[model samples]
Target chain A: MKNYLENINKAFESRARLGIMSVLMVEEKVDFNTLKDTLQLTDGNLASHLRALEEAEYLRVEKQFVGRKPQTTYYASPAGREAFKSHLDALEQLILNNRQKD
Target chain B: MKNYLENINKAFESRARLGIMSVLMVEEKVDFNTLKDTLQLTDGNLASHLRALEEAEYLRVEKQFVGRKPQTTYYASPAGREAFKSHLDALEQLILNNRQKD
Candidate 1:
């Protein structure tokens, strides 16, 4: 069994990063603008976090044009998905362990 | 209904803080030593995070003498408990919503 403390992904430590993962988990693919609006993050803020996730290989990015306007899209990689699930599992495990002490 | 994105507590943003709340939620009260050991955090690191949580009113601290030595204990305040639960609920909602897209 994975220890709860050790299983948490530090990459998801920020609320912004965590929120991004949450949206990606369901949507599978999200545009930079949409993600920024949904998470209410600034352009630079969202970009930095996205870059971090990308560097960690937790997210995949694509740049495409819509009607000649450039659009950036993001998707959670397979490793990203597993890391997120494990993080959620760790959270649940911690909660359950605490509940047992009640 | 609380908007899933806005409901997440930024106060629980850190892995250490989240772990602290997790331990406090079930145990009702945990000494600083136990928390430090359980989370494997450095003394300064734990103190900084604990101070942050306490400042946010998510944790209560009590300093007293255990035998001849001074011991500090921590507990999640009512607001803290509710906040953590809300954060957890938001995470679950995000996950469930993602599952539906599958």
Candidate 2:
């Protein structure tokens, strides 16, 4: 159990962060507005969680301008992708362990 | 994603709590000492988490004495089992979503 739990990343514990990563997992790149709308998070809430993931190096941020407007985009880093995958694997193991007990 | 993430119980957000629930999901009843040792948590740490789970009504505690020594045991309440099952289902859905994306 410890072995299985160890891989579950604390970074993705927040549902917002989990939602962010889940989106990034399927999409190559997501802009700030798209993510905010998809996760239904306010700007501040989304920024903070995104910053947390960036600090963990699980996510990378790119700021660019589309015409006159500055747009921020997020991408799950290589490390982040690996870590999230391990976390999901751990979750799967825990679920499987329960079923086997049944 | 929102639908899947919504079912993850906040009570199991902590790794310690997750470990405790995972153990209880498999075993009918576990004593305090065994839970503490199995999760490798300090007495206070384990007690605090146990208290949180108890407050959430996810666990029921039974106390008695073996000779002069006191014993405390834990069992996952029926509600807890259902909640945890739902949480695990949400996790499985998240994992499957990722896999399907791949």
Give the C-alpha lDDT of model 2. 0.90
lDDT of each: 0.84, 0.90
**Which residues of candidate 1, in runs, are more than 4 Å off?**
A98-102
Tell the DockQ for candidate 1.
0.44
Q: Residue by residue across B2-69, what tens digits does model 2's lDDT show?
A: 78878777888877888999899888999999999899999999999999999999999999998999
Where does candidate 2 chain B have its weakest 10-residue lDDT segment? B1-10
Native A-B interface contacts kept, per candidate? 0.47, 0.62
Q: Kindly report the TM-score of the first chain in candidate 2.
A: 0.95
Best by lDDT: 2
lDDT of 2 at B71: 98
lDDT of 1 at B8: 70
Residue pairs in collision within model 1: A26-B98
* Cα lDDT tens digits for candidate 2, A11-102: 98877887999999989999999999898899999999999999999999999999999999999999999999888888888889888887
Interface RMSD to the true structure, each candidate: 3.5, 1.2
